[model samples]
Target: MPPPQPRTHKAKPPSPEPRPSSSILLISPENKILLLHRVKTSSSFASAHVFPGGNLSSQDGPIPAPSSPERHVDSPVYRLGAIRECFEESGILLARHRDGGGMLEVPDAERERARRAIHSGEEKFSEWVKKMGGVVDADALLPFTRWITPTSVPRRFTTQMYVYFWPLSGAGQDAKIPIGGDAMIPTPTSDGGLEHTAAVFQSCATWLEQARRNEIIMFPPQFYLMWLLGKFFEEGKGGAMELRVQREKVKEFLKGSGANGVPWADKVMSPVPLGMFEGRAVLNLDHPGPELKGSGRRGESGHVVQVRFSKEGPRDVEVRDAVEMKRLMGEAKGKL
Candidate 1:
């Protein structure tokens, strides 16, 4: 028998660098935001209902200098990726006619075909838009916030969150606007049930209630953003009034938050795990992470999220306000 070879342990590969990605909160005119349900077997955010987003591609084009000192170095790339992903995953193309006539009007059949071609790499997104004689309406995306995945995760992404108020003007006769109005809006549909299972526009509060009741899983970022948005549109507002009021209110917020044309302003969040509360993990929403010390970016303090993780995925998310978060943390520290 051959002598046993000396045992040698293989060294672990280095963790991947955080990829630049973008997510869009597609705020409908009806005071709701579009959410896509990821398949349960997804590599990231498995089984979670999340905003439309994906990693940037080389076809997204070269990164420009920060739009302002407050914007990330890759802000332009992020914006492009956000628009492409939103269209690929949700069938809502954010672009306009090349001659600046108005929004690009494509039949649903053509839209679906183009979406498949772009998503499958048969053609680049930019090239496809140009082929259709349109320019991406990236300017319509308003910077909402940015989130860097925690270091503990094996795969990480620096995702820029954007708010896009879908315009319902100049729709073709074949458009499907769920609301009772005659105005036509781009219909949202899943990408052939591949990456996402469903694409639906539902109110923030309704989504929050669903997550709270364990009907769907939402990661902390989605949960936190929805919690913030829920504060603006209450439940009792009437139909069209709710839409108009919410649109104006959100526009005001974006204008106020994104003062001086700096992306995200002070709303960069890098959650740091402080401890566990009950069976859930408690994270410090305000921490800028060790890598970002002295970066000057800050999240709203005194707010925390409790999320439970299982082998399946993250579930049971709860965002605690200042008072409740203080009580929870104080009790954990034996100071309450």
Candidate 2:
């Protein structure tokens, strides 16, 4: 008999931790949502139409106590980060005057200067707002949803999504504080083609249609959220909904739970991959990954979204039912 050899095992690589990040759906007074076209050279989410947001920074704020029920853990920081990133990426400051003058009103030249300074890290975001005699409208950002990147991905993030009703047409009667007029509405401008190429506002249906036709690229998250937002608008109505009325309807939806009694904000979505269909990745929003199964933390089921992956970026997003998704996946598997 040959000499016995000691057993050897290959160690598994450590899983990447999900970085805390925040994004905002900036809803215009006309009910359109702002979407930024990311630079093609960017490392992540390159060439995709995404919401304004970035990673949570240390200067955002201190984390909250985990046991606190009033607020989600690190939500204050997330909100601050979302506002800052929004300003940095789209030049739209979600801020109000400190003197209770509603939205902050400053000359366009001054706003651009401040934006440049903040983007260059020459000044801290919160300090600049305070110096300008304004306060960040953090509370304006309502908790919309949260997405956790799948474990299979090399780079991961825990992104907190929020919705901010930018009163471009003026704050509605339902608003507690009296916000200013059109002068206070900050215009959306790209960051000199640094990270974003353009900042555009279009109806959710328009964006969804573009994505469906492969005209623009939208990742699974943005695609799914836009689909949900489209429901609030009337089809073939020229996307005409008064600002006040739209704000009230959105507020009601955010306050109440979704299809079930469970609040949408409470849901921590981690879409589980079922299979593939026609070169597209099919993800199941109803079920979290195997690791998250029985965790009781992931919230209610939503929709099934698919995206065709490419070397440049993802494209051709579509929403389908579970049965149709399974059938497509089966056909794709058989083709292989």
Candidate 3:
């Protein structure tokens, strides 16, 4: 008898780590929801559909206390960050007084004080909450879904999803501050924040129906939320009742996850299609797969080319160059 030969195999590479991000699922009093179409820029997702959110800042932690509860306005420090992000991204604020008063009436000096403190890192969100004589009611935000970006991509995010209900009173008016940059304008009553180049309020059923029929182009997160909304629509009710139920469902879902769930899931490939032509290709950022094909044409001095996909599909993304198009298409192929 002879000793058996030892066996050896290749070691697998370590999986890539995920990044962190945050988003809000805001529902208005009329049962309408807010959505944003990302700007078409290298620094942005480029026409991708998304909820109102961004990477969480260090200022999102805690804040100082005001002299007294009665003197405080708005929400707590951390929550105020969420409120500010909502206002900046979609022009919606989740603040309300226990006495049923409006947040708009909050004094500019106090609001400005809190804003400056947070932005300057002079205050913690918790301290700010205490100063405002308010509580950081995490309950106000219902946890929804968690998503992570794929390791193959240069950019990634580990995101937490939160759902908030905006009453009928908060649905119609827009905040006066600018959305992204320093420019200011009258806030649009709907979701017309500066960051949101295009915003709309529609029922989950309408959004889902359009998406299912290929009338709307949406990223996975938006599509998934819409699908969830469709489930509520089937119950045959509309307005505040439906919104409340959805909010509760989201709350329950978050509570049930406990501590074992991942902070976010990897970004799923777009569900649409892709194409390659004339040294250039078109990729649909909303959907996955390579079966879909489209054309790209050089414009003006030919320094830039416009890549278009799906003649009637809801998603229409324009890639700047052949290199980018090829890289994106390669990613799509790898997913397949």
Candidate 4:
């Protein structure tokens, strides 16, 4: 016996953490964005007006079709989930025929059928996509911001928000109907009467105003995004092409930062220290808003990021000083 084999220990790999989720900000051809109103009785973000999205599903896995932009970075999963959720909640499909036949051109009647089927769980989204011989148009989804739910929140979700522009049909010479901007409008729908009760396409500024008035609720990440979108539109960067360019700029800016590089996965998942915002760079973390102190959940700490929406467009994002932040908001509001 060869000296009875010496014992060796191997390190155990870390258990798989909960997977991340993705959301879509559907921007219409005329510059409006879509939002869904969560039912009042729900637990997480009850009665909050949020973007159209939900947790990823295994049904969103790979199929035998070609998708525009192929995959989102290294996986086709998130993009497919986003498309399915959007279709389920809003009755809008962001896909095209695999043969390059352009966006799915289904009649309003068929659209309702698909929406009802998926919403009821009677039909899996992937099966429907395959049956139609269409592909998820991931190219239309421009990467926007990354956000993580705060530690104070019991159930945390790591979410990536994408901007998808609803292209004009381009069939008619004069077909431009502006959906909305800066107002509190209700979209109570009975179609996807499951997770979501209604959908709205409010102007960014108006959405903030509604939250302030206690008409609807908003969590930290949602409010932050609306703040940026409010600036983008209020300063007239609302055009489709203009907004697209700005989205790319923001992506590059975040990528340039080592701590917040492309995918931004590392920084976005961890808790953002209070001291990290001293440099005024892109810190994609959640901090409770001072303005909403008495109203909104306090989040991890008593902190907020106030941005300056200049005539040139979102000039700066500031998170320090209570008085100064209020003053800046006043100035921005006046200008808007």
Candidate 3, 1-336: lDDT as tens digits: 999999988897654444335677766554556677665552546555567777556566433232232111122333445555664554343454445444433343455455456545686644554455444445567555444454444566545566666543331223443322322222323233234467666677676556555455665556655554555444345444554676566445445421223221211222223465444334333321121113121111111223333433234323244356567667867887
Off by over 4 Å in 2: 1-7, 63-74, 171-184, 235-241, 258-261, 287-295, 323-336
Worst 10 residues of 3 by lDDT: 295-304
Please report the candidate that would top TM-score against the real structure. Answer: 1
The segments of candidate 3 whose C-alpha lies over 4 angstroms from its true place after superposition are 1-17, 62-81, 98-137, 168-194, 209-216, 234-336
lDDT of 1: 0.77
Report the C-alpha lDDT of model 2 over 1-336, residue by residue, as the tens digit: 999999989898866766778999988756678999999998789888999998877778764332333233336889999999998898887888898777766566777788788877887899988988889999888887788788878888778899988765443222122223432245688999889999988889899999988889898888987787777854444333445566677778777775435677766677777767767778877654333456565544545778778886778778776666787678877887
lDDT of every predicted structure (CA atoms)? 0.77, 0.75, 0.47, 0.56
Relative to the unseen true structure, what is the C-alpha lDDT of residue 159 in candidate 1, on a scale of 0 to 100?
74
Residues 110-173 of candidate 4: C-alpha lDDT, one tens digit per residue:
6678888876678888778768777778777766554555454456555657777665432111
Candidate 1 lDDT over residue span 57-137, tens digit each: 878876432233423433667888999999999988888889976777777788889899888888899888888888998
Residue ranges of candidate 4 with Cα displaced over 4 Å: 1-19, 62-74, 168-192, 235-336
Give per-candidate clash totals: 0, 0, 28, 1
In terms of lDDT, the poorest run of 10 residues in model 1 is: 65-74
TM-score of each: 0.86, 0.85, 0.52, 0.63
Better of 2 and 3 by TM-score: 2
